[model samples]
Target: MDRALLNALFDEAVAKAQPELAVTRFLPAQPKGRTLVIGAGKASAQMAAALEKAWPGPIEGLVVTRYGYGQACERIEIVEAAHPVPDAAGLAAAKRIVDMVAGLSADDLVIALISGGGSSLLPAPADGLSFEDEQEINRQLLASGAPIGVMNLVRNQFSTIKGGRLAQAAYPAKVVTLVVSDVPGDDPALVASGPTLPLKGTRADARRFVELYRLDLPAAAIKLLASDENLAPQPDEAVFARNTSATIASAALSLEAAAALARQRGVESAILSDAIEGEAREVARVHAALAKEVAVRNRPFNKPVILLSGGETTVTLRGKGRGGRNGEFLLSLAIELDGVAGVTALAADTDGIDGSEDNAGAFVDGTSASRMRAAGIDPLAYLANNDAYTAFEAIGDLFVTGPTGTNVNDFRAILIR
Candidate 1:
């Protein structure tokens, strides 16, 4: 398969999943009174822009996006902040959002645009808890190798706005939430920690995660989690009676788009699964094994077929690596493929940023392993140091797309010819 075409297919998947394509279709009807738009996430700004374009009436709102993920919006205000980590900007934005939604009458409408990466972009420390305390816990949770559900369970308990509190704050106003899912199973509560969704989890679960991971958190955070007061609102709460939510985009949709493109190109494609979750390197090894089987024995399918998958993957971050999970997966797959011919692969985060790095991800082909060795770049060493970014950069295979203004988790493709 042509490498450029393979990369192009990956790009197609991302483009298909963009908010501009999916958001307009899921928009709610215009409210009778003023429309107040509010949201947070990597894709939220783009989602807001889409809303403004589709809505015929005047829209007033505020949304927070990752530092580089903000898009142009005519009516709604866009706030840029940090992602994968909470910052003062996020805290201020979160506070402003809560204030904006307060004291609204029944005629007012609240449009919430939520997506992945919002957990960090919309952080608000609970009462009696400091922003520094929340930041510390966020740092620990990210490094704990916990799944998104578990991490969000803990994070929601510490936030003043997450776990349906955003919707609760907009009580009396008809709230319609539009989401772009980036979690396994497309569970609404796990996306961006479910800022506008109901709380299905309990404070007990949050405390359990802290103990399970042996997280060292501030005394105030621990105390809040242990207490029953100020807990997240349940589904039965009256605020939820007027709430409506829709998932506008997700991993499954993007994966199908990629598979469709492959079929159009006269290449067979099989989407293994869109709900996959696990360690990045281990997941890559499994994909590599399947690709080898297809290339050598042709058990899964005939040659010239591409294997595609999408979902969120975690890295334990044992070493001080400079790469994200996508880069790590590519590096591991390369080592496992061991210079096998007629095999090419690409792995990247759909959001156009992997982990905390600038590059979306990396690529690997038949000669990648041997070329790295010849260039004195050891894959194992880089992997051990969690530095796949440098290893792939040395081979000139780092895939950089800047900010795509969309997020649905990771996209991986393995081509066997």
Candidate 2:
């Protein structure tokens, strides 16, 4: 199997979601009055840059993205902050964005460039919630293994800027949100906790998730959730009546791009799903089962076919090891498919960085586990530690692509030849 072919397929998926290509198509007509842009996510900065190039009218605003994911935009301000965790930088930027949209008139237009990672990138705590408390809440939710839907409900309920508050602030004005979705089913509202879209569920729903996930939230966070504050603006609210949102890029779209490329190159391909979710290792086991079936028995799709899937997976941190969700998934797949010939796979985050490591993901083949063992590293021991980054590193299989400038979620492909 050609590792280069796998890499090319990954590149095609990423190119399909590039901000410059996707954002321009979803951009609304230039407003009659001043256009203000504001957003937050891994792709937001690049999205802003794309907007500036495409929009005819003058645009000025702020967008926050994960550190090192910032893009250079002449008119729009690109603010870099911490991600998968909130920081002082994110809080300040979120505050500024909320303030910026206030006092807008009905004639004005506000465009929100939202994508994955926006939840943590825009951490404007609600009233009486401290920054430290907000940070703790994020850390707890991420480690809790909660699905994105539950996590979004909890996060949006506690945020002053998210959960449609951004749109609420720009109310009376026409707000358009162009999203690069990284969530299951490409739900725009779930993207970045729906900063510009209306809130769904209830505070009680958020509280239920807190308890369900057993989150060790800060006292202030608990109090906020328990309080009967103004419910986040609902879909029926007048403010959202004039607002509009579109998913410009998504896991489904990117997966289709990869599958299309494979078929074009004479390799039969099938997409099992574009919305799978669960613990990283557990998901790997399921995919491995399907791959082994086709590879050995040729029961499902026959040989010389590529299997593709896209979805976000969670990792419950049992041991303090270095890896992103994609790394963890790939490592687990390697172990399950040990010594099986003519099989290769790649699992990566579309935005390039996977978890805490610089590598977007890692490449694994039938002999990946054996390679680790030959290098005196135990595959099971490494996966147990959540140390897939180091495990792949020892065997020179880590895929390092710094910040691909777009995120549609996790991309996984299996080649059975």
| Top TM-score hit | 2
**On a 0 to 1 TM-score scale, where does candidate 2 land against the true structure?**
0.98
Q: TM per model?
A: 0.97, 0.98
Task: List runs of model 1 lying over 4 Å from the truth.
Answer: none
- lDDT of predicted model 1: 0.88
Candidate 2, residues 1-417: lDDT per residue as tens digits? 478999999999999999999888887987778799999999999999999999887889999999999988899999999998998899889889989999999889999999999999999888888888888888888888888998888888778888888898888889999999999888899999999997578888888888888899888877778889856878888778888899999989899999999988899899999999999999999999999999889978899999999989999888888999999999999999998988899999999999978999999899999999999989999999999999999999999999999999999999999
Please report, in order, the local distance difference test score of every candidate based on alpha carbons. 0.88, 0.91
Q: Could you report the Cα RMSD, in angstroms, for every candidate shown?
A: 1.3, 1.1
Residue pairs with clashing backbones, model 2: none
Model 1 scores worst on lDDT over the 10 consecutive residues at 1-10
